[model samples]
Target: MRDQVTSSDRVNYGAVIALVAISFMLLRKWIAGGVCKSRACLDGKTVVITGANTGIGMETAKDMARRGARVVMACRDLTRAENAAEYIRRSTGNGNVVIRHLNLASLYSVQEFVKEFIATEERLDILINNAGKIEFDDLFFDKRPYSPLLSYKQSKLANVLFSRELARRMKGTGVSSYCLHPGVIRTELIRHILVRFPVLKIILSLPCILLMKTPWQGAQTSIYCAVTEGLESKSGCYFSDCAEKDPAPEGKDDEVARRLWEESAGLVGLNPRR
Candidate 1:
């Protein structure tokens, strides 16, 4: 019995060691960092990033500021935005970083932000629609009970549509718009879900967490979209991992893009222009 127990213990230890090794390899691959190699300077460029207070948005803002771009962090929380702006300014030594209040959930807020931006800023060089949520059943047109998951999906779809319409409108203009998937980033965006389910939090804390990307790593594609030259003609396309990728069928539908733009304009109390 003692011999058998010893053999079992050895087996368990070997399994644990193997698991650790595999987890390390997975983590190395997961965090294989990618950065925009373009040395293009944004000396006179203006970048407005929504949700720039945290996660990939903050990292993107930092990168832009490092390249001498004026970054405007549009966030709902003034205090947090200010804190992030201070951090970016200190880190990048870019004094042009500013914070503006924006709440994507409210059309009034969106309109107000647009009005203020147009009034104060002379040029809008890049618009990065980086903020998204994962709510259940929150479809824009759905009258059913509020589903946070659906709401999140609707918001993402809205980003793509907005970019598409904006690109069409800015065809001749120098302003460019980009929509990107920042990857499965490790951020507080999932805190609400984890708070409700302790088990999930534990699982995510395990070696499997290696699959997630840090905020800085997740910002690579956005940086690529913003400062990379020769991409002026590729506006409105979706990107991931610093490369363009095809979006879902719904996202690629021109009619849907037009309709969503009209609906969004109505929601924001703006007259829709083709």
Candidate 2:
């Protein structure tokens, strides 16, 4: 027996479809976060991006390349880096993309990269330290068991402190510093976590896509901070979603930031006293 196609039933179906579409649109808009509305060009600028071979770093590099900036991709994996650089060059039609080796885990590598860059490159307009790992520094972890997640959080806080102190120190030097939260993008970071616990791959599959930002979306604030004018006045402030946002109370502790800077400089054999 066939059910009659009543006008009320058709209207109900249309209303349901329209409601679902509108809900999806709202969810997408909310998840997209703040976009970099600034259409500033970076012609004649030289930008260096760490971890530019993947995720938000690569996306940032591509945007700079498209803006006619000479982008140097500093990445740990030379092979992957070359591939990323090529992709950037081809997609951007800007052949100024270059690749260099940079292993943040190794101080020696950092020193070497800096030396080589200073020797080869004439000027550095922007230095984006976009690479980070699930690494250490407790404040190195209150004598607790070493957990990667805790280590990563500590590292991020350390970055905020470093950026704040750097901005204070670099004032009047024609340089600016900024730190940001990229809003939990679905990048290779998730793959690493899933590798350790494969079950999470299944558990997180739905939410990862539904809730996480794409690499392009995550890179928006980085691009904004790098190229947006008038942001110089707000340098040192923490940013998220392409706008200035206050960090937590601990992050704003100038005394702690300065102390951490001194300790970090000592560890890295740098003279922050300069």
Candidate 3:
């Protein structure tokens, strides 16, 4: 039998579909907001955020601090971290801000940062992996024309890999580790992509700008993962927009995660018990 739909039926179906879509979007946003609004959940917690000098990381640091959490802004540049922390202190009126140096690409730097963090504090409540970079051209925009691009992907992968390894090591230490993606908010990070492909960048960025969350919105997930009640059980999970995310295929490789851990341990000279 041939299935047929009347005009009124079609219209009603379309309306239903549109309503469902709108409801889903609004529901997601509301849940995201609620996760961050819990007052006592974050109070007195210590959170360390990488790349907190700017963009979503900075916003997360500020938001968490406002909720009475001690925030540590970890960045490679000491000056920048301190400057960001000062801004947070002034804005939130919470002075429990500390600046620690952390360079994600360099394992030695991560080790030093972790050592300092562990030495100065007896307990760590949260560690947020928010640092990343995007490089557009290798030998100038036109000189190297069209080669395979891998840098940005590599950095993102590293963020997840590091979080997994760190979570493993911190298993019994009462510290929860999480990796977060801030939903590609407008920031200096996108400048590299924009500069390389100016026209395409604008075209691509348009949809993201329209639908993408603001830096404050982007910080929602990290804040949620950092403070939510059942989060300790979700350690090493990748999160975006306050939802648990499935890391890329490579990110799910337990062996690779272990290798990265061993490699990092070697770099930091932390001997693992075989």
Question: What is the TM-score of each predicted model, taking all chains together?
Answer: 0.78, 0.87, 0.67
State the lDDT of candidate 1 residue by residue for 138-242, as single tens digits: 335455676776567777777777787777777776666777777777878878888999987897786535667878888888788877888877877778777
Query: Candidate 3: where is the Cα deviation over 4 Å?
Result: 1-35, 41-45, 78-83, 100-105, 118-148, 193-208, 267-274
Tell me how far the alpha carbon of residue 162 in candidate 3 is from the true structure, in angstroms, after superposition. 2.6
Identify the runs in model 2 with alpha carbons over 4 angstroms from their true place.
Answer: 1-7, 105-142
lDDT of 2 by residue, 1-274 (tens): 1355677788899999999999988987888899998888878877888878999999999999999988889888999999999999999999999887766965446657765654332322232222233233445556668777767767777778778887888787666778888887888975776898878888888888887899999899888888887778777888888888878776787887788777777777877685
Q: Write down the lDDT of every candidate, Cα atoms only.
A: 0.75, 0.78, 0.69
Backbone collisions counted per model: 11, 2, 0
lDDT of 3 by residue, 1-274 (tens): 1335577788899999999999978965754342465464456667777788988789989987898877888888898788889999999999999887666766566656766555432334343333332232332235545433454565566667768877777887776678776665666666665798888886877676655567787777777776677677788887866778776667766676676667656656667442
Q: Comparing 1 and 2 by lDDT, which wins?
A: 2
- For candidate 1, the per-residue lDDT at 33 reads 52
Q: Who is ahead in lDDT, 1 or 3?
A: 1
